[model samples]
Target: MVLEKVVEILRNYKDEQDLEVTMASTFEELELDSLDTVELVMEIEEAFDTSIEMDGELQTIGDVVTLIEKAIA
Candidate 1:
């Protein structure tokens, strides 16, 4: 459920980039830089109504999903 929403947000963030986004897709592969990642995180937090701590590394969409699950758990 959360992954779907995250993917939706990510796809919007994907902008004009012609890349496929999946749970296994890394931010790097999506061509998202640090600033883009931050913006993405903010959007996710707002969508989920929760704040995510940058206490660990987040590489892929799955990683972000896990973090959000923990936050909203």
Candidate 2:
């Protein structure tokens, strides 16, 4: 469920030049800036009805998935 929503959110920002986003894909690879990351977190929080404190620790898509799982758990 988390992966699906993450992918859906990512698809909105994906460009033709961007690589296909997988669990290993990082924010740098996706060309997401700090502002983009902030917006993404906000969307995730809204979707899950939870708050995620960004401590500059999240890196990969997998990291976000794990965080969401942990948050919702």
Candidate 3:
């Protein structure tokens, strides 16, 4: 569920060159700035009905999936 929502959110920013975003993809690889990250977190929080505190440890899409899984668990 979390992965689907995250992919949906990511799709909103997809361009011709960025059609593929995988779990191993990092925010940097996506060219997401700090502001974009903040917005992404907000969207994720709203979708999952949970608050996610941003930490330095979250680097890849897999990290976000793990975080949401842990939160929802």
Q: Which candidate, 1 or 2, has the higher lDDT?
A: 1
- Candidate 1 lDDT by residue in tens digits, 37-60: 989999999999999876449888
User: Against the true structure, whose lDDT is highest?
Assistant: 1
Return the candidate ranking by TM-score, descending. Answer: 1, 2, 3
Off by over 4 Å in 1: 16-19
Q: Model 3: per-residue lDDT, tens digit, 23-70?
A: 898989988887888788788888899887697777888888888888
Pick by TM-score: which candidate is best? 1
Candidate ranking under lDDT, highest first, comes to 1, 2, 3
Q: Which residue pairs collide in model 3, if any?
A: none
Q: How accurate is candidate 3 locally (lDDT)?
A: 0.81
Model 3 TM-score?
0.85
lDDT of each: 0.86, 0.83, 0.81
